[model samples]
Target: MARSGNVWSRAGVALFQLAEYLHEPGASVGYTLANWNISFGGSVAMGAHRSSLREPSMVAAGVLAVDIIDGNGNIRHIQRDESSDEWLADSCPSGITTCTV
Candidate 1:
């Protein structure tokens, strides 16, 4: 029983460490700003999530979309509409440049 408890404890600790590492600021798998105008400062994954809320479609003119990776190690388009300005404004700060759409 004591041995089992030790094994469980070690496993829990290992899992916790793994989670912490995954959540760490620099541990992301990819990164990108929906709009190129926004500057990013972190691992690729962190940058992607942070920039995903900006006026990607308006700035990029439909080129800026969600970040996704495909089996070929390439980023796939996630698609964003020009009409989502409200949601983008809500997610991004006011100082950010608004989409003219």
Candidate 2:
């Protein structure tokens, strides 16, 4: 969490929890998914999202980085600006990774 009300979480965190956390007095996510039961990692891997012309398709725009567990069971730290992960973040859902933000 930050002074600006921006909060970051690990992949295990569920959207429901995030929604609740973001529900501070006057804060909310720019984009929201109807089903809040999904895990952050699941959302990212499946590219879950909602369409919007003004706002982004998903909350992925807010993600700074992701540490994904590759097929080999190794943790891969991918930054938002990396070409491939950039595509992943834009094309994928929103926030994700394994244990860390």
Candidate 3:
């Protein structure tokens, strides 16, 4: 009985940490806002009820990186020139790995 409570307590703490990290703008490519226009967000919910057996829950985590665009067109792994604004990125919100509202 005590062991079960410990497990859920850890899960709850992890959920809170993840929520805080998501609030940040995005992962820093250069540790600055030059190319820090990435999007990373999701919803997390947890509820507890009286039960003898523990129910499994699904948790998913993934990266939301920018799709690069060189002078020609959309491509993978195109280096961005932070000094000049010529480099481009896809309109991030619409472009996601497998994002959902």
Candidate 4:
């Protein structure tokens, strides 16, 4: 995680905690950003049995959508591979939707 010097720094910490909680065995998470009015949901799947003496692993999947915000905030929607600068400045229009990995 990146660190920022501001009062909203707590937001980053909270987000990290939320991620950790979702990674717990049999755990899941769903959240909405009230300020941005966008919703997100995802779950973690445990890969190894608990009784085995091997390190456990997890996989996660989720999607995020733009609510009323314009393509500016839509950077959140870009796939993990897409470049934010290219998409925000060149690809999508004002109010359309785009999905990222």
Candidate 5:
């Protein structure tokens, strides 16, 4: 849904505890997203997955629409595939920094 403009971040990963289970292994991911028709430049689509030889692996993708926030609490918008010296490294590639959803 990120690639299709229906998700928030372009890249994200789900995490679970390392506890032992007696049944077959599996993971569950779920979330709520807001709707917006706003358009902006560029997107960085990426994904990853894991599976056993007999199981199916899943694929995912997403995008970014807003540019950056200014020093005076203003938001700036930029063209697709375009970058400037003003963009902050922490914002452009918004990656998850935690081990849980």
Candidate 6:
């Protein structure tokens, strides 16, 4: 996981831990799962949602970019706005990774 400015990034981490780290006055994750023990990668794979009904379950909605390792062991960084639909759908939601956060 990495923290750059207000854009928090994660590959594998506990949801509660992430929440704790982001917890502070005026600092929040915006959307989170009710089950704190769930891992970030797992949640993304499961398409987990926040407790609020207004929020959607597509966790990728909050993600700005993702670092993925291809089958050939290549680290490919994909940005939300600049990436293709196929790349985003295949990499972000699957939680398939051969690289560390």
Number of the predicted model whose lDDT against the real structure is largest: 2
- What's model 3's TM-score? 0.18
Total clashing pairs for each candidate: 3, 1, 0, 3, 3, 0
Q: How far is candidate 2 from the true structure (C-alpha RMSD, Å)?
A: 5.4
Name the best candidate (by TM-score).
6
Task: Rank all candidate structures by their lDDT, best first, as comma-separated numbers.
Answer: 2, 6, 1, 4, 5, 3
Task: Sort the predicted structures by TM-score, highest score first.
Answer: 6, 2, 5, 4, 3, 1
Candidates 1 and 4: which is better by TM-score?
Answer: 4
Per-candidate TM equals 0.17, 0.63, 0.18, 0.20, 0.24, 0.66
Question: What does candidate 6's lDDT look like per residue over 1-101, in tens digits?
Answer: 43435545566688777777777434555567546787766776666766556755566566666676666777877666635764456544544442333
Which regions in candidate 2 have their CA more than 4 angstroms from the true location?
1-6, 82-101
lDDT of 1 at 81: 57
Q: What lDDT does candidate 6 reach at residue 52? A: 52
User: How well does model 1 score by local distance difference test?
Assistant: 0.33
lDDT of 4: 0.29
Looking at model 3, the pairs that clash are none
Tens-place lDDT digits, model 1, residues 4-101: 11011121223234334445443421233244333331112222332345434222222234443455667544444547753343233323332222
Where's the lowest-lDDT run of ten residues in candidate 4?
Answer: 39-48
Q: Candidate 5: deviation at residue 92, Å? A: 3.5
Q: What C-alpha lDDT values do all the predictions have?
A: 0.33, 0.62, 0.27, 0.29, 0.28, 0.61
For every candidate in turn, the CA RMSD to the true structure comes to 17.4, 5.4, 17.6, 15.1, 13.5, 5.4
TM-score of 4: 0.20
Which is the better candidate, 2 or 5, if ranked by lDDT?
2
